[model samples]
Target chain A: MELNIYHLYPEHLNLYGDLGNVNCLKRRCLERGIEVNVVNFTDDEKPDLNDGDIFFIGGGSDRAQQLVYKDFLQYKDVLKELIEEGRAVLAVCGGYQLLGTSFIDKQGNNIPGLSILDYESKYTGDKRIIGNIIIETTLNLEPNKLVGFENHGARTYSKYQPLGNVLVGRGNNDDDMKEGIVYKNYIGTYLHGPVLPKNPHLADHLILQALRNKYGDVESLEPLDDEIENKAYEKFIKLYGK
Target chain B: MVNVRSMIALYAGKFSKQVLKLINSSGTALPGKLALRIDNNFLDNIEEKCDTVIMVTGTNGKTTTNNLLNHVIGTRTDKILSNLKGANMIQGIATTYVNNTKDHYDYGIFEVDEGTLRSVTRYVKPDYILVSNFFRDQLDRFGEIDNLVEDVYTTIEKLPESTLILNVDDPLVNKFTQLPNKIIKFGLDLDLDEVQNSSLSMKNCPLCEGKLQYSSHVYGHFGNYECDKCGFKRPNPDFVVSNLEEKASSQMITIDYGDEELVFEYPYTGIYNAYNVLGVFTVCKQLGLSDDEIVSAMGDFSFHLGRMEEMEYKGKIIKVILTKNPIGLTQVINMISNDERSKTVVHILNDNPADGEDISWIWDAYTICEREETVLHYYCSGIRAEDIALKKKYDNVPLDKIKINDNFKEIIDTAIEDDVEIVYVLPTYTAVFETRDYIENVVKSN
Candidate 1:
C-alpha cells in the first residue's frame, strides 16, 4: 500500500517540531512495509489537495499563520470537499486555529480562518494555556488517554463535538473540559507533543483511516508492538494526571 | 560609610558562595539571586566599578563565545571579570558584579541571557555587545524569536555608544544592524561542504516578511540570503571566516580582516563553534589582537565544559555533548554521524526550569538522528526519558534497541558494557551537569 501525504505550508507552519508529526507518520508507515511519499506545499507551490490520501498542517507563529491563511484561501472549496469526503486530516496548534472560523490576537483583531471546523479561537486574556496535556480519547474505538504538550494563547470554543475529554491540562479553552475537534476523519488539536508519536494509538488510527479511505477496505490492521510507545504514554499520563 | 548597601550585598554574596562551597554545590545561580534581592543596585555599583564591560547575548553560543573573549583578553591582562559559570539572568549578572567589585577589572565579560539582557543592560552599559545568533529557545521562558530580537533591540537602542557585533548570516540577527549603534558584523564566508539549510524558525525575511532565498544555504536558516522582494540581504561582514575546512576534531580556517588575512586552526569542530570563534575573533580584532596572539590563544583554547568533552568510561571512550534546541542538537547529531565510530548513543532529557518545559524539540532532533546509519544502540534517560524514547522509536530505531532508563547510572553502565568502542552521549542544559557528574564520579571510578 502506498500513502501519499501532503504537508500544507510546511516551510512556514512547521514550528516547535510540528513536522515531527509528518516524520512519525512517514516512518511508521515505512516500518509497517507501506510505501510513503510526502509532498510539501509551501507559499508558491499549489498541491492538488485531492491527490493526497492524508493531509497534515502543523503550527506556526501568528505572522506565519496569517501568510499561510491567504494562500490557503485559494483552496478553501477543495479543502471543504476533501473534509466532506472523509479524507484523513490532522491539524495542530496554529494550524488547528486556522481550521476554525477565526483566531483573535493580542490586539483583539480577528484573523479570519478556514471555517472548516465549527470553532472560533480568541486571545480572550493574557494567560497562555501551556503544560503537558493528557486527554481521554476514543478515536480508536477503545477508551485511551492521549498525551501531548500545548502552548497557545488562543482559547478556542467549538460548537461541534470534541475529539476527547480533558483529563489534565487546559484544553480548547479554560472553561470547557473538552479538547480538539473531531469531525468525520478530520482531527484538530492544541496538543503539539506533535500529538502523534507520543500517542501510538492516535497515529495508527489516522493511518488506518487514511488506508480505509484510500482502498475502501482494510482488515483489522496488524498492530505493531507499542510497548515503548505505551510506556511513554503512561509515563506522561502518570506525570501529568489521570 | 563604605557604601553600606553595596557592602552588605557583597558580604551576602560572599557568605552564600562560601556556604554553597561548604555544602559541595556549584551554586551557579542562587548566590546571585540572593545578592540581587538584598540590593537592587548591586550590579549597577559593579558596572561603575569596571573600566570596560563587554556583554554577549543570544539563544546559543553565549557561553562558548564569552569564554573565548575572557581567555584572549585575560591572557593580556589579569584584571578581568566574566560570568564563566553560565549564570546569565539579571540576578546572576548582579552576583558576578557584586563578587568582582573589590578587584579593579579592565573588562567585565558576561554571557547575558536573552530574556534578561534588556534589564541587565540598564545598569551595566556594555561598551561592546556581541549577539551570536537567535533561534527559538526556552519557549516557555521566552515567547518567540521575533520578540527576543526586539527586546535586545530595545537594549541596543539604549546603548548609543556601544559597538554591536553581529552575525549577518542569521537574517533575524542581521536586522539589528539597522540599529543606530556602531555595527561590527561577522559571518562565515566559505563554500559550505554541504548545503546549509536553516530551520523552519527563519523562513520569512525579518524586514518585510518576504521569503528569504539563499544563494548558498549554509546551515539552519543561516547562509548568504537575499530577500529579492525587499532587497534586504546579508551585509558584508568585517571579520569573515573566508575559508573553513572541517577536520576530524578541529577546524582549519583562514580568517580575513579588511585587507589582512590570518590562517588559524580553531581547536573545535562544527560550524556552530566556527560562528562562536568568529564572534570572539571580531571582538579580539577590535581590541587590536595581532594574528600571532589570536592563533596562539585559539590553539590553546578548549570548550569550557560539556561541549563535546570526551573521557574514558569503564575502559571505553565516551563523549558528552550539551545540546539545547533543535538547531544546536542537529549540529551535534551531524558531528556524531560524520564520525565513523560504532555509535551507541545515549540521550539525556530534562524538562526542569532550566531545560524548556516543552519537549517538542526532541522530536526534531530525533528526526535528524534517525537519518544516520551509524547509531547501533540508543538509550534515553533523565526526567523525560519516555518522551525521548518515543521520539527515537518513531524515528525508526527498533523498539528492542531503544531503551528508556530514568536511572542515569544504569544507562551509563549499559552504554559502557555495550561492545561499541565509543559512545556519544547527548544531554540538555540540566542533564549535562548530572550526566557529567555520573561519568566523572561513577563510570570513571569504576
Candidate 2:
C-alpha cells in the first residue's frame, strides 16, 4: 500500500514545524508497511490536488500567508472534492484560518479565504492565544485529550462541529469553550505542538482516512506502539493542565 | 534640575544593586528595570558619555559575539561596560548602564535583543551597530521574523552616524542596502563547505516577493542568494571567511578584510560560531584593532556562555550543545552524524517560558536516522522528553536504541554508561542549566 501526501505552500507556510505533521504521517504509514510519496507544492508550481491522498499545511507568518493566498485558491475546488471523497486534510494555525471564508484583521479588514468551510477568524489585537493547549477531542483518538501548543493572534469561529472542547488553553475564539473545526475528513486547528507526533491518534486518523480514500473501504491501520506519543501527551497534561 | 532625576536614578539603582547582592541575588534585570522606572534617561545618560558604544543585535550569537568583542577589547583597556550575562532588552541594557554609570568607559558593549533594537536605539546612540543573522526565534515573544527584519530596517533608518556591520550571506540582511550610513558586511566565502538544506527556505525574496535562487546554500536560509524578479543579491562581504578548516575541537579560519587577511585558529567549531567570530572581527577591525591583536585575542578567548560545553562524566567524555531552534538543532544533528566516535546522543527538551512554549520546532529540525552506525543509543530527557522521543522514534530509531527517561540524572548516567566513546547531550535553554548542574554535581561527588 502506498500514500501520496501533498504539502501545500510549504515555501510560505513552513513556519513553526508544520512539516512535522507530514513527517509523522509518513513515518506511521511506512511503519505499517505502507509506502509514502511526499510532493511539496511550493511557489509557482501547480499542485496536483488529485494525486493527494492526504493534504497537509502548516502555519505561516502574516506576510508569508498573504504571499501564498492567491496560490492557495487553486486548491479550493479540488480540496473540497477530495474532502467529500473522504480524503484527509490537516491544516494548522494560518492554514486553519485559510480554510475559512475570511479573516478580519486589526483594522477590521475582511481578508478573503478559501471558503472550504463556513468559519471566520478575527484579530483581537489584544493578548495573543499563546500557551500549551489540551483539548478533549471527540475524534475518539484514545487518550482523547489531545495535547499541543497554541501561538496564534486571531480567534476563529465555525458553526460546524468543533474538533475538540478546550480542556486547558484557549481554542478557536477563546470563549467558544471549543477548539478547531472538524468536518468530514478535514481537521483544521490552532494546535502547533505540530499536532501530530504527541497526538498519535490524529496522525493515524489522517493516515487511515488517506488509506480509505485509496482503497474505498478499509478496516484499520496496523497499530504501532504509541508509548512515546502517549507519554509525551501525559507529561504535557501533567506539567501543564487538563 | 534636568540632571537631578538622572542622579537620583543612578544612586537608587546602585543602592538597589547592593541590596540585591546582599540578599544573595545577582539581579540581572530588576535593578535596570527600577532605574528605568525612576528615570527613562538612564541609558541615554550613560550612552552620551561613552566614546564607543557597540550594540550587538540578532536572534542567535548575540551573547557569543558580544562577549568575544568584549574579551578582545578588554585586553587593551579595562574601561569597558558590558552585559556579560545576556540581559539584552531595554531593561537589561538599562541595568548595565545603571551599574556602570560611575565609570567613564571607553566601550559600552551590549547584547541587545533583536526585537528590542528599535527600543534600544531610540534612546542611545551606538557608534557601531553589529547585526549577526536573523532567524525565526522565540515566536511567542517576538511575533515573527519578517516583522523583526522590518523593525531592524526602521531602527537603522534614522541612525545616520552608526556604522552598520551586516552578514550579507543571509539574504534577509541584503535588504538593508540604500541606507545613508556606512555599512560593513561580512559572510562566509562561497568556497567554503555549505549545508544541504536551510532550516527551511523563505522561498520568496525578502526584498521582493519574487523567487529566490541560491548559488551556494549554507545552513538555514543563509548563503550567496539572488532574487529573480528584483535584482537583489547577496552583497560581496567586506570581511569574508576566505578559508575555513575544522580542527579537532576548533576551526582554523582565514578572514579576508579587503586590505589585509587575519588568519587565526578559532577556539570553537561550527559555521555558526565562525559567523560570530567574523562579526566580532569586523567590529574589532573597525575599532582599529590590528590583525595580530585580533589573532592573539581570538586564539586565547574562552567563552562558554552555556552554548556548547564539554566534561567527563563517569570516565566517559560528554559534550553538551545547546539546541533551541531548528537551524541550531540541525547543525548539532549533522555534527553528531559526521562524528566517528561511538556516542550516545541525548535530547533534553523543556517547555518552560525560557524555552518557547510551542515545541513545534523540534519537528522542523533534522532527524538522526540511518546514521545509528556510530551513535550507540538515544536518551530523551527533560520535561518534554516524550516529545523528542516521538521525534527519534519516527526518525526510524530502533526501539531498543531509543530510551525515554524524564529524569536528567538517570538519563545522563544511562547515556554515560553506554560503551560509546562520547556522550553528546543536547538540551534546550532551561534544560542545559539543569543538566550542567547535574554533571557538575557528579564531578563534585567524585
Q: Which has the greatest DockQ?
A: 2
- Taking the candidates one at a time, how many backbone clashes does each contain? 6, 1
- Candidate 2 residue-wise lDDT, B1-446, digit = tens: 25888888877888899999999887778888888889887777767667899999877888888888999998899888889878898888877877774447898898888878888888888999988878777788777787788888888998999999998888777677668889999998754444454336566788677888878866787888889998789888998998888765788888887687767796778778889998988899899988888888888887564577777766777787888887788877876766677888888988787788778778777768336788788888888888888888766788888888888889987777788788888888878766877877776777
* Each model's DockQ score: 0.62, 0.73
lDDT of 1 by residue, A1-242 (tens): 99998999888887777787887788789879999999888777887778998899988777778888888887878988899999999999889999889996545587789887668998776687788888888475543878788888888999777888998888999897899989899999889877887776787888899999888889756777777777777777667785
> What does candidate 2 score on TM?
0.94
lDDT of 2 at B216: 80
Q: Write the per-residue lDDT of candidate 1 for residues B175-255, one digit (tens) a residue.
A: 988888899999988646453432433768888878887777567778888897898999889988888888877898888
lDDT of 1: 0.81
Candidate 2 is graded, for docking, as medium
Alpha-carbon shift of residue A39 in model 1 (angstroms): 2.6
What's the lDDT for all of these models?
A: 0.81, 0.81
